[model samples]
Target: MNAARTQTDRTTARSPRPRAVLAALAAAQFTVMLATSIVNVALPQIRDGVGLSDGATTWVVNAYGLAFGALLLAGGRVGDLLGRRRVLVAGLALFALASLAAGAATSPAALIAARALQGLGAAAIAPAALALVMESFPAGPARGRALGVWGAVSGAGGAGGVLLGGALTEAWGWPWIFHSVALATAGVLVAVVVCVPRPPGGRDEGPAGRFDLLGTTTVTLALTGLVWGLTTARGAGWTDPRVLGALGASVLLLLAFVVIERRRPDALIPPRLFRTGRVAAGNVLMALLGSVWIALFFFLPLYQQQVLGSGPLATGAGQLPFAAANMLGSSLAPLVARRIGARATVTGALLTEAAGLLWLSRMSADGSYLVDVLGPSVLVGLGLSVAFVQLTAFAVDGVPGKDTGLAGGLVNTTRQVGGAIGLAALTTLAGSVTAASAHEPLREALTAGYRSAFSASAAVLAAAALLALFLTRAGAPPAVPPAAPAPRPLTPEPSRAP
Candidate 1:
């Protein structure tokens, strides 16, 4: 009895507390997302402080995104192979160091380089953290609830970054944004070390195979080229030879990646994974969702600050209603999914968001926040939160345990890539519309441009809603097959005869 009691104590000690694990993972996810948007409000100050030109100012944001998106696949795979805890710890260390470097930098080059490094760390952190969440929770109400929390934090991070950035920049200048992230990241790292448990058999117990170096290289370069080309097009125009060349090279590299994945036994992304229809369809919908989501954050702030003449603090504060609504929707998503099914929930959410965007597109130059922004913001926030949760569930729904990291990486990659492309395209369109309306008042012209982008985003979301209808049927069961009935024993027949 003493031995058995001792063994139970040992098992209990070894097992990680679920709440602690969830908190650590969620904190990690929030930090990575915070890095993405925290700098937007501080960009002008950063540009002046670091002597950045207009072009260089833009790179301060794009550099992080490009690196993050490009390396996510490799980062996720590395976590899966090398150990999630190990990769997560390393990523947190790197992210902290990079944030310090960024904060201390006096030159544009140093700052940009540090931001890129931060992105690399973020790439590793996001997927590993998400995979750990999946690993920790079994599928059912528990996982659904966990994912709802994930979705809430993820959505909150975007808005929260803006709110925090504005406050930090206002109180202690722009460098404090980086400094704050570093400090928070260090705390999260410590929590992860204490709370997160290693897998059985040790930290290195992954599939035994050579790393797919060729596939990794090809895909990374391809994503880099694609993002670079799109980012350049926003400022340099699509016809620029540099942009054209980058796009062309990216296409070729992507084709090569496809070929390499098919031929290689240890591919970065197995071709067979696409055979799962949900995976493919889910990613497509996620891309469309991302296109609108990213642009919404970008344009909303500009509209508040530039068109409405709001200060940075006020602009950030204005997003509270939206953020609150988003959190509420995220918390409610699982309950709604249980009632209506994930597919139908996603479809309804998309349509709801589209309606909100359509309403936003009708904003006037002389509009008030309550009339023009608040109501629509609530609608969009609710819809966006729910759609994000359902779509995330769809993407990783039937993936194998070993490839959970890969699945996380793929979903993240599509969203980031789609955001980049959509931002560039929408920015260009808005710029053109604004220029064409030169005869109007400056505020009016700007409003028109913003309105156009909102309308376009609404159309995109509508299309996604339509696509969701065909992709997954309502009330469809999980991909797991039903268990077979047990066989009857021969002795049972003799007993019946007797």
Candidate 2:
């Protein structure tokens, strides 16, 4: 499938250009998501470096999710309006510059702003990369394989991000995490401009459709307000007037955005897309799966730190199985999907994820990685492999070429938004329960928070299972036509009639 896309992506990509293009595009996805996970393993250092509280520090993470989530559809649309290759190049340059700025930053506010800009760049790059793959490959054996690689990079990027961050932060400090990424960004930016081929259409020279300004503003504010309220409400009470106002305003803003979308001719997301049962199911599942992933990474690291009493390096060690397992699963997904179909692969995946959640929930104070984490890690890895590929295929399935960007953005948007919502809700749940407990202040409270996040993650994965069941059609392979009946050997009567 990837080969087919490679063949179609451009005249330039027909031979050696394919390998270069794939590597650069994959590298682009890997690097951007790396920023999400890389800084995560260094949160303690980041907090101290910026002179911020743990609660304030969480915003550094959420800002990326919020901006990336809200602007994703628009970004995808922009790529379609302009060109995927062009937007990708521009985004890469912007991203590299942002990474340099982030690394040089000395204050929390500066880091937060830098991360937001990074998210904006990522928003442009992600959908463009995926759409380019989709536009290149036809739906069949080849597309599935390409999607498998695409899924793996996304799923494994999180694990690799944290691992890379841990190594860099320990050796070079938190700022170097951003610095290391900057170096890659600079290299990849050059590669993209040089190696990545332009789409068949040259560039979108169609009429400039009106940008959905009102929809953009409302959606961004709605998501940002909601994430802020939920993140902060943990430290301040939910009823704290500021938190309440923010949460309330966010809800109102979202409602307004929905109303605007329904009325707009050039809606970022058309109303009918939601009505497509498959697209709707796939979008919902992506969001839930995203929530599971982001929340797990957030709390699991805490488990090693506060619960298991590990430092950053030790936390990185603890993630070894998860990182390795995800990598292994990702590596094998394309081959497996080709042998067995994407439908069966994804169905099995969601179920396995639910089981992994149940196993992970068994974590205890005395738990070891072998007993408490390894099996679940492998299962979650497998699930990620299946879900990521299937969901990407699911979103763009049967969408018109003109709406390809919208299709890609819809799935990616679900993921980022789900993560934001998941983080807010999961974090709030943990904080609220911990605060109400009669235990000594911090550690026990945080433990309760971790459990809250885990349990919520499990629930979201469970919901994902249900959504996948409904969203996917039963037959992944189309039915073959019956063979024509064999002719009688040299029938003289039939020959005469003919």
Candidate 3:
């Protein structure tokens, strides 16, 4: 019995702890998110240091997002084929190196290039990390809880990025932001290497098919064109020749991609995946929600700084309430979903967010943060966080194990693409409204523009809530179809002495 007990202790010591694995995965997720927003506060300093032109300065932010969004599908497919853990480690290493390069860059072009490389790494990390989470926890209460934790960390990362960016930019300097990310990411990478187990099967285990090169190229380029066009439209106007040309090329390329996907057996995004109503509806609603989510972060900071005369640090600090509420809501999502079901929970959350946006639309030119920002921010935070958790679950609910990475990528892609389009359109609308109100004081005109954007966002969320009612069934998620055979156990085969 003592020998047996000793044997058990050795076995346990050799195994990876589940909580440690989750923590490592969550840290990777947080690092990816932090890279996205951390640069916003440091842009001015970076611009000054790099001697960036106005156009180049914009690209500093856009470059990261564009690469991240465009390459997600390809990245996910690569993970599915190459092995998630292998891909994850590779991505983290690349991200860390890119961050280091970004921090040490002296030229505008070098910084932008490094940022894009960072995005490429993030595209690999996000989907692989999420897919690993789903794989780690089986479907049911455990999965739901894991997802809640995932959502909470994601929300916190965004807010933390801004706060950290402000503090670091003030205390250490702009480059520290990237250096800090590099340090944190390197730490996460080591934790992952230590804590996460290898894939159940060998690293090469995946669906038996060749990569769809043509389909991938077309879709990636199409997404790139679309995102670039939208981003260009912000400064160049929708009717500009360049914008029109890019949009036209994207539309054509997208059509070509659809045709190629239909013909190819090993398509990047299998058409069959969308046969389930939940997958389609979930992505749609997520897109809408993402529009508001990204827009809120962008415009809220601008309002605080421009209209309320708040400094960057104060603006970052003010988001604390929203961040706290977001984390709380994410934590509670599983419990709420268990009681009311995911569909109902999603609808309710959308309505709550809409209500908050509507309230925020009434902000005055001379309004204080207490009366105008805090209450609405709490509501929006709670609602957005809960909705995101539910929608994410919905998007991948019945997906096959073989395509889990693809589903993760798909959901992320929609959110990023929607955010780009929404931000551009709303920015344009706000500019137009502000121009129309030029007769008023500058502050009042700016407030009017912001109010209009908020009102429009509220309407969009309300529409999304109504759509959620129709798109999903009344009960629990539909059952998953028979998937490909599960991978072998993580234990390695015994080796014979030579």
Candidate 4:
């Protein structure tokens, strides 16, 4: 009782500024998200240092991705179970330590392991931080402003990572990429500890129940198999024994996961949420949009580096337009969403994205960045910015406040998992396209591959827009917009009494 009361005191005290917690949360989000791009600029050096083949080195990036994306949902649930602040701090600390391990690693295996650890930490931190923001701010203009700042920083983090990675790689070698993450994230972690308040209802981590351990196991194995199948489809035919067996195993495991969720007292993926159109639609779109995004980052760099003969740093720089546009669009999204309604905003955004993707597909041996890149960027930027901001609001509409964190998790998980699948498929398709152009010079072939991939990506984004249209309920009066997301999970919230 005493402990519970003390926690209650912390929630009600009002001593620390709420905006301070918001500030801390935003910075933490930016720092951790930088992990998404910090490795891109160092791909060459790390490839050389670790003696990794092209396919294998992809894992150095995907290891963190696989871990972070797979575990995001479970991480969100964990935050709801433990105190959010405690989890955030611990995640930051673990992330920093993992960075240190990655930086000093001497072997390929060590580096891969460290990267996985970093993902694990990120899984914990990302959701917890979002939950913190949701809890810290009320759901209105204040939350909107906070989310806008969060979104801009989120976009900027990618640009920052690219620039920083290039600088570090040039000045201090590949290990410096890892070292920079460690040093920067640690500082943010300290600030978070000092500022963010504990949950209001005390250690509000509800009673510990038996987690869906079986469901978790099956899902993990299933995704691992799927990724494996996708990864080696180039070397090993899709019909090859290894590939077929893994994919077949994945289906079986996923089926088992569904059965497990149905029987468990506490399910891993609660089916009840899917009954709501907003939750279900948001999740599906998140997955598909993620695919669009991963495809762009994967191919855009190749376009600049392999085709244009730009170096790694220059390749990173080429992405600046998208990043900057994403920032501008995100910053302005709430206003747009408020005016048009979240659903309409999402639709418009999707159309914009489709237009951009179609234009982007025209890349050639000598493509026009000014014509091809700039115009498409406007569409991509406006579409993504609008869609992301609005889809987030759509995710929580009519959801009971208590389910906010889970709601957040569902959407975020779709994005992470979809990205994994998208990357695998797009890379495979690009390889086939490039191989078919064997008569062309190596650079020419590579450019052909990027063009094909970019076109396909645009189609997917168009599909996502169409998907968003049917997923949301039509004709409902627009409610006030909710705060958006950058990281993978939900924020805490006050109850929504009718």
Q: Highest TM-score: give the candidate number.
A: 1
By lDDT, the candidates rank as: 1, 3, 4, 2
Which residue pairs in model 3 clash with each other? none
TM-score of 4: 0.89
lDDT of 4 by residue, 54-171 (tens): 7678778877877787777777767666656787788899999999999998878899899999988988887777666655555556666666666667666766777777778878
Which segments of candidate 2 are over 4 A away from where they belong? 1-16, 199-208, 272-277, 331-343, 436-448, 474-498
- How many residue pairs collide in each prediction? 0, 1, 0, 1
TM-scores for every predicted model: 0.94, 0.86, 0.93, 0.89
Tens-place lDDT per residue, model 1, 121-178, is 9999999898888777666677777788898888889988888888898999999999
Per-residue error for 65 in candidate 1, Å, reads 0.4
Candidate with the greatest lDDT versus the true structure: 1
Tens-place lDDT digits, model 3, residues 1-498: 999779656755676776787889999999988887887767788899889988789898899999999999888888877777888899999999999999999998899999999999999999988888777766666667778888888888888888888889888999999999999999999998888777433343545567789999999999999999998998899999999999999999999998998899889999867755377888999999988887888788778878998876887888889889989999888888887767789999999999999999999999989989999999998999899888888888777777778888899999999999888888898889999999999999999999999999999999999999888874445322222234323232221110
Give Cα distance to truth, residue 451, candidate 4, Å: 1.0
* Model 3 misplaced regions, further than 4 Å: 1-13, 200-205, 474-498
